[model samples]
Target: MPNLSTTYLGVPLKSPLVVAASSISSHVDRVQMAESAGAGALVIRSLFEEQIQLDSMQLDEFLAAGSDSFSEATSFFPKIEHGGSKEHLMWVEKTRKAVSMPIFASLNAVSPGAWVTYAKQLARTGVNGLEVNLYSVPTDMGKSGSDIEKALYEVIESIKAEVALPVAVKLSPYYTSPANVIKQLEQHGAGAVVLFNRFLQPDIDPDTETLVNEMVLSNPAELRVPLRWAALLYGRTRLDLAVNTGVHTGRDAIKALLAGATVVQVASTLLQNGIPYLSTMLLDIQNWMDERGYKSLDDFRGKVSQKHCDDPFAFERAQYVKLLSSIH
Candidate 1:
């Protein structure tokens, strides 16, 4: 059997396939199942401060809307149980006790003080590491791109100051220059960088004249974006790069490693398929390695990356233009 062992953020993993933060971590049994099914690590569902605040705001709006139209509406709703960071901290601790694999707690979109406070509390849970989901949406017209990047740096620095756990920042791909962001994060002591965070885009319902706000699982084609960037960034920085946002198969995972990704994170794929399916993906990757006579993941990890590939320009826009022109 080929050696699938690899390390991310200085933490050793059995394979490069990591279970991304999602509802799969909600149950202790499920997390254990993932580990048994061959996951490298598990990132618990995020403690999303912004998501909690959004829920609160919507609740207030609901009460206000009903206060005037229906007097009984105010009394009908149940008390909001946002579960706050305290509840999340307890749950993460429980999960940590249940599993032997490296457990990472996610803290997303937190306030200034909450970043330090929650980060400290989470680190106390005995998790192996932390994943900071830097969910930045550039909606504010006044906030320049530089302002957003600076805020991200401060967030990481605050968390680092509060905790000793290895931390990885999950970033959005919309940044003006993602490589620069990674360089800054490396300087700020980030152990790893999860390539891209997927944003929930709101759709419109023309018939109802309302919005369509729901989560959509990613498809395999979405892997291209991170694949390109990962290959381009392979030898450019010292930061560990984690490819996410469209990896769904064993072949997909292999592609990421070939492009120099330290690891590949999956959430939607597990959700769409069964959790046991993880073992299948791992088996497929193992078969590929055996056929290629690759003894370890590092044997050909970056073989196809820009640094080692025959054509470095294959990852750039110049190649993209040439391919299109050649087609006609």
Candidate 2:
């Protein structure tokens, strides 16, 4: 049997396959099942700052509407009990008590203050680490790329200064230079970088011509983006790389490791195949490692990375001009 143990964000994991933040953490039973199914670690469902802000605003509106009776009735059980930050903190505490595996609490905030504040609260939950789901869509015409990047760094720095737990940033791939962004995050004390958060894109309904929110699961092809970036940044940085988005099987996890990823996070696969499938993926990876005579993860990890590969130019290309000219 091969040793599948690995370390992520300085925390020891029994395996490199982690259950990414998804609907899995909604219940304690499911989280325990994932642990038994061979997941090294689990990221709890994210606490969205937008959700907290909306709840706060609604509570204030009710209080100011002269509905003293209603407000008094809801006072015993504050808005925090309904959908505020307190609920998430309580849930994290409960989950931590239920499992011995590393449980990382996730926070998705848009503002620097919100990020720092929530990070501190989450740290008090006794979680092993924190994952910052930096969910931002740069739609404003007045905002430049540098402006958006500055906001990201500020939030990271603020959280780092306030929290004691290890912090990992789940980044979006739409940046002009992802490597540069990762470097900036590391400088701000990020322990790990989760490559390419999958964004929910809106679709239009042909009949009504209205936009609809779609929840489409990622495909295996989506792994390529993170793979390339992970390979490109392998030897250049000291920060741990966590490949996410579209990872479906154990072989996919192996591919990520070969590209120099410290760990591979999977959500769509477990959701589609059920949590027990984690065991199967782990078995597949072990089998592959044994067949290749690789005793440990480091044996074959980064073997195919841009830094180790013969042709580094494949990772950095311009228009495929050479390939097109050769084809004709």
TM-score of each candidate structure, all chains considered together: 0.90, 0.92
Q: Which stretches of candidate 2 lie over 4 Å from their true place?
A: 60-83, 322-328
**RMSD (CA, Å), each prediction:** 3.7, 2.7
**Candidate No. with top lDDT:** 2
- Give me the candidate number with maximum TM-score: 2
Q: Write the per-residue lDDT of candidate 1 for residues 184-256, one digit (tens) a residue.
A: 9999989999988888899999999999999999999999999988998998888888999899999999999
1-328 in candidate 2: lDDT tens per residue? 9999999989999999888998999999999999999899999999999998898898787665645666566556444434579988999999999999999999998766888888999999999999999877888999999999888888888888888889999999999988899988889899999997998989999999999997999999999999998899898888888999978999899999999999999999999999999999999999999999999999988888999999888888823788788885
Superposing every Cα of model 1 onto the true structure, what RMSD results? Answer: 3.7
